[model samples]
Target chain A: MVPSPVMLKPALDAIGKAIDQRFDKLLAVPDDSRARLYEAMRHAVIGGGKRMRPLLVVAACDLFHVERDRALRVALAIECIHCYSLIHDDLPCMDDDDMRRGKPTVHKAFDEATAVLAGDCLHDIAFEILADPATHEDPFARLELVTELAVQSGPAGMAGGQMMDLVAGDVTYDLAGITRLQQLKTGALIQWCLEAGAIMGRASEGQRKALRAYARDLGLAFQIADDLLDVEGTSAKTGKAVQKDAAAGKATFVSLLGLERARAQANALIDQAIGHLSGHGPEADLLRAIARFAVERDN
Target chain B: MVPSPVMLKPALDAIGKAIDQRFDKLLAVPDDSRARLYEAMRHAVIGGGKRMRPLLVVAACDLFHVERDRALRVALAIECIHCYSLIHDDLPCMDDDDMRRGKPTVHKAFDEATAVLAGDCLHDIAFEILADPATHEDPFARLELVTELAVQSGPAGMAGGQMMDLVAGDVTYDLAGITRLQQLKTGALIQWCLEAGAIMGRASEGQRKALRAYARDLGLAFQIADDLLDVEGTSAKTGKAVQKDAAAGKATFVSLLGLERARAQANALIDQAIGHLSGHGPEADLLRAIARFAVERDN
Candidate 1:
């Protein structure tokens, strides 16, 4: 889709390395009770992912010619929030899904109780990692990271969007309502990723605003592609059951706008995401590639 | 009981005003989708309990002659964490209780999904409130508040203790096990209250340590009294179903040691709490009154 596999693979590799290293250090809180919590946190966090958020961090830094190591902890911290949300969202009391990443969901793999605690602990540890001076050099930057992470993950964003998903069945859904839901549910953390990287790299306000615009557009495109995949792809390709979105009566973009129009929206968003990176030079090539990848991926 | 109504009521009143004012300001985030979550959080946080944590803040601030207003935001923050834990603990997937404070648990009052979100939102908001510069004048004080709040509420502290409680169930728990459980579950927040207050007041390390000792002892005494009340008090006084601990087969202080031995432990803890406050003056008097009140309060 983007003809930029060369750029994507290396950023993905760096994201993997950064996630593993920072995860090990953050899990070392010195109390047995807390240690147990961290063990569960480790299980959920490192379990598996496309590592998209961390990749955003590394790619954004690389785009700015900033060192990847400088953004490592922030990368892992954002992923921790992502992993934690997945764990909680998959609980029997929530989405009630049994499969995630082709494996049993956290509540099924670990005990539901442990899954709950693991998610809670990871959420806190993310902020703790961001706030720690050893990881984040600038106090103001640290504050901004913490503030952004909290806002994105908290009521006004991811969690609130989830509540809406729970209450608003697909039966009465519209395109605007579905987009609004996806914006908070899926877009907040994606925006956090780009913003966090830019902040850590000390990007100018305009550059940061551009990065955010790129992320927001890319995030919506990514979610629409996911909904399409759930509808059109097989279980083997996506690692999740195909067509379960419709079965669950979810308020997805495809469900609201039909497959054709939904696909069109994703392509438009991808174009916008790439458009925002026009003046940033070759460093932003990977980000542009990612925006294309978001809408074009098979799974 | 040390027989001092003179100090207790005033601390409670001040704490009420602090929590109400701070909570009002904190929940004003500009997102309508989150408005429902904010409403649920407001429902859980406001008009609740004796404001134990906030009282600790006021008492500790008074010890150093720091203005109670300085610790107001921190007081509200810690209370938010306390409220969140309670809301989650009452979820049907967790403790499954239907009643708290003479009314329905969050899950019962709202939906289970809303309760889960209410807890998640409150947890994030706690740190959000604490990190705001409006909470404290000194930047270092703000950092200290964040650290203390995270330590007390995160894995090593309240959440871990909660996990322990979940796993322990009714398994012939011993005195040491019960004490450790209470220390983590309840004592952690109380400890934060004292430590955060002293730190905000810029008290020396020694002063912070002493206040911590007082809180630790007070918390245990409070828990034991709560156990005794569950066994003897009516639902009207306790604001919960009578004999819930025994019915749930919970391993409480009263159940482990019998009423008489539990009373002895409560008295010992009260004495220790007072001893820890010995060097501090009128402020210590307020703490001593709290110690006496904890072991003897009807509600």
Candidate 2:
């Protein structure tokens, strides 16, 4: 794993702060008539978790010294996608989880119908942010972000991966299949964030390739870390249910590879992820710290 | 109501045929892994209603002699939004309708999970089409479509309207409130179809305003007609559950105003809708005919 700098914590916290402020401004709906919908949206998005995706976006963009405003916009747009998936995934018709982040799920706080609409509405708003000229003056960059997000979030990407998860009971998957599933479900969005930052920064082809490599390895390592947390962490810490995969008899990294091997695999992936970013200078230290954070965090 | 032109029937049929074929080609997902999601999408979109939205797009684009391919792409994008809304609306958590278009709803035919994701994936693909350079050479046109779609489809628009319908049990609405609900729920999309065409064709401000006026009046008339149909039409003909609004004790145009008055009001709206197009000549004859068809249709 890459050495973590003392400043990495502050860097991550800064990105988190920027994301929260921007989201508050964007999600503020003054229209009392639609105030309820906005309330649901604010509940789901405003107060959230690690915000690792935004951190990756900011760190990657930092590598190219991209404009902060545009980078933050992209970060906010992608964060909406992440929040929406969580909302939908927690719906009664889907995961049926009542608790998320130690609070009542959107559907639990509101209603199923409102939850669904809130998720769908968030998904729409995400694209709107990417398409705006404020996100990027270059139309190609805006279009790139829009098209890539769509593909990454569509049936060909996140939704497709979700279908596999829902039907996981009917089918059996080995390690390789489970790996592919994890890659599609979470890997795609994580990959898009880094690529989106590259698009915003107008990074070189070689730089783009390196960031993607870093993202891919980091994504898998992150998922493995999640599996580890589910197995070992408490609900109070993660702010979500623990050991759900084991309870459901679902195949996850720890289940397939054994807990010890899963831990080793995650560490190796983090090392590789850090290695890919070696071409960059100290500006990428946050990214390196994030790679270690992916596997080392308690929650 | 504008008199139905002798050519209007053939013109609408032509547009319907075009939409059907294009949808077939576009929705063909070769990846067998995600075939179920694609199946749900096809079931919801193809072999459907009058395809009125696509007709509006084609008619408006025709006024500016826009290229057929680009116009078709825009038409398809808007239709995806319409179909997605219908699919989500039919979910068990939403309207809970088992039947749609004379067949099982997406949730009924496939499952609720597939239905939800299919609607989501379709929504994503709509933006994907708009973002592509093939939609328009000018990125501003694409960006405008994206931004407009987000606002019209978000808390201020369709989703907001759906929320109103969901919480209808909690409150009562007067005629004006119900009108606002219906306009936000359905009117916005209809208006966007017209506005989107104007953008694609680079219509003059006056032309855009004229098309919008025509759309606004026509949209209300269309909804009033829908209310009337729900009261009077048979389920078999509409390929849907009729009189559901009345059964649910929901206030609609027919319930707010008596049937005869509602019918008269629809006619008046249609006449005013047609009046908006008076500035145009024979080229807008199809639009004039559609305005008449909005109120006079059986289903």
Candidate 3:
């Protein structure tokens, strides 16, 4: 069943706060010369947007009875990947965006040189987190986490997706091609979040299967919603400039399917995403709410 | 025993040829639109370097009789990290060098955008290599490798070192401070290369301790020699610019210690590095040779 509106909000807020605290704790680099880098990393990740990834990891871990501490570490790791991508994507060579979350991009707040190094460190630490025994007691489990996270976030995953996005203008891709692009670019890491809980909990094969399917549909829906926001989200609400995709003449789900059709598609995906969690009870309610929110959120 | 000049040349040649083949084989990216990114990654790593890191990995693995194929793969992975670092270091925001290995840097050869992505993928794939079951049958070993490599390469490792290098001009560091900087910047990964063999062989604790000590000294010797090159060697042989240190007013070993003392320091470290390997037999002869070459090479 869907979580009560009031119930999910508090949970979401709590997770966000927890992520902020833990990230601060992790990023407290020594007061040596390298402190500037740690400062940039902290600046990039702290006080950010909706902590959807952490929320997913937390809710999923709740399903498996995994320890909160272990799951939070994985949450931190996955978020680092997300944060790093954002930092790099905003580089002068990449998106050239000046602002994110209503604040200066890392390059602007610091400098281009610092921004690049900050992004690199964030990426580096994500793998370190997964590989650490703190994430899991079983070495095999830790290895799986490391390899899967590496592959999912590497060339085969987000990096490859980013390549496709960068070259999107150079080549024409059909809707299917675009879907594959978004699926890997954003979908890959989203799926990783869905698996984070299961990985921490070592959930049954059936549970893992259902959540994987849930994450895929939800991941696509998240992108569709993002595309919708690009077309329709106000800079005030989204904390980013709107309608850039259309301005760039890039094809997105909304562009391909039209506004009405894109909305319909996203709603369908939300339903499917919710269906996958049917086997779980109240423990998975927040995930259900998260799926709905993925489509419904203004941001 | 220090490997004779004659004995070392053949072994070095063999390792270089093997690395070339293996790198070529691993980098055959699919012939798709994303091939450009792969092409850039291939271009950055394909032809370059003395392959010292690979040699270190191979010699270390040889100490334990690890399979050649496995050792080569580890060598490939570590070299990926090294190559990625060079690519990023050449970025306009970083060192901004136009050439490497006497050819156009990746950003110049391609574009800054492609160079960034290419470097990112190379770093990504290095982790992928270590995480692969093919790297090692023991999952625990793979985890150790992944964690150690990630730790050594991340903010605390190479990335941190790069940050420090970027900020070197801003901070006034004496010899101890400079030593700490170089130790993290280049020393960490070099140490990782030494540990790679022990990780593969699952060598005894004593063996790990000795090799690590050997690696620490050798790594410092290698950097000191690099400083010496910046002072004494010409770009013609180094395949890159020289005298960059003094020109930038950087505080390198040579700058802090002067040429004669720097040479003396490197020699002493080389001796210490060699002494650490006293327990190994003929199989370690190549390691002994490589240690000397680390400090003695013109490049």
Candidate 4:
């Protein structure tokens, strides 16, 4: 049975609060000049976004009954990577975004230099959190988390995807090229979130494979939803510029596939994503709900 | 007797070659649009700088007789951190420098967006290398390396120091303030190098304490030398802009202590740095030579 997307709301709100509190505790402002750096980081990370990635992590961990605190730690690490990337991407050199999450972007709020350093500090903190003994009882698990996050976010992953996006205006990409780009840019970290859960829980090989398959389809569906939002979402709702890919002449899922076809494709991907979890029962309801939310979310 | 600083040259050259080769192998360009990003990273990392940090890591590991391969992996990781820091620092919003290590800065060689992503990619690569099992037979050791590097390079360390440096024009830093800033900025990573070696070797606490003391003094002396160079060296000799600190009215060791007093203090610190290594014989000679070279080198 398909779960109601409304059920995903409670989990999303709970994860959002947990993540905000964790960042607040971790980024206490120092009474020094460096306070500005911390503030910039806090400003960028403390209150923003859909918390989608962290939610994905927590939901995956639920499948294995991983400790909430342990899962939260991994969630925070991935969120930091996400926040840092957003901060850098919004810089005048990249996206030139002024607003994020309905507030001034880091560079817009605290100058370009501070934004750069803040993004960098957040990047360092992600690894520091993953490497902490508190994150996992076994050192091997902690190491695995660190390695997966690093590989998924570095070149050939998120950063590599961003590079492709940066040159998208000049290089004409067909559907295959766009799919590859999204897989690296947005899909890689999303994939890491599920793998992290499996690592922490020490899930069996078959279980891990099931989660991997779920993540892959969910990631693609998530990107398709994002492309759809870019075309249809209001700036007020999105909290940042919309229609940017189209304006830049960059080929996106929506740009290549007409509006009706793109909506159909997103729904199809979500259905496929949900199908990947056929082996699990009611325990996987949150994951199923999230897959629906990926396509249904307005922002 | 103090070894001649000249003895440090052979080790420096060898580590430089090894690091360059490793980066070359690690960053083979993709046959896609992301090739620009890889080129920017290779440009920033390959065939550049004195590689002081990597050399320190290798030398410290030598004290414990850790496998040369293991030490090199750790060294490459640290070097990546250092290189990424340089690339970011040279950004237009940061130090705004054009040349680094006698070549165009990454942002100058590539576009600003590519430079930003390249620096981030290198930052990711650093943790990936440390978290790899090949870096250490023990997962605990790999986790320790990742933790130490992240802590030393994050908010309370390198990035924090950079924030203070950025605000130096507005903040009136006295001797203590300047010292604290430098300690966090430069001293932290140098301290990490020594600790990494100790961790890999599983050194006695007393030995770790000694290296800590040595690193503290050497890092300060290195900064003092840098300040001295800023005041007295030519841009051509330094491969970067010179005397910008004085022009900006920022207080550095040389500016606060006067040239003669600063030079004398550096020499004294070097003497103290070498004194911390007195417990060991010729195996410690390279470290001793490095301590002397820290204050004596032109760049």
Q: DockQ of each model against the real complex?
A: 0.52, 0.76, 0.75, 0.94
By summed lDDT, the worst window of 10 consecutive residues in model 2 chain A runs over: A1-10
Q: State the lDDT of candidate 1 residue by residue for A57-154, as single tens digits.
A: 87887666665566777788888889989888888778787877787777776677777877887777777777888655677777777778888888
Q: What is the TM-score of each candidate against the true structure?
A: 0.93, 0.97, 0.97, 0.99
Using TM-score as the measure, name the better of candidate 1 and candidate 4: 4
lDDT tens digits, residues A202-256, model 4? Answer: 9999989988888888898889988999988999998999998888888999889
TM-score of chain B of 4: 0.99
Cand. 1 TM to true fold: 0.93
True contacts kept of 3: 0.73
- Candidate 2, residue A122: Cα displacement in angstroms equals 0.5
Q: How well is candidate 1 docked (DockQ)?
A: 0.52
Residue A156 local lDDT, model 3: 84
> Looking at candidate 4, what is the lDDT of residue A131?
90
What lDDT would each prediction earn against the true structure?
A: 0.79, 0.88, 0.87, 0.92
Model 2, stretches more than 4 Å misplaced? B1-6
The iRMS of model 3 comes to 1.2
lDDT of 4 at B149: 91
Cα distance off (Å), candidate 4, residue B263: 0.5
lDDT of 2 at B205: 96
Q: Which lDDT value does model 4 have at A127? A: 95
List of clashing residue pairs for candidate 1: none
Q: Give me the displacement of residue B200 in model 3, in angstroms.
A: 1.7
Number of clashes recorded per candidate: 0, 0, 0, 0
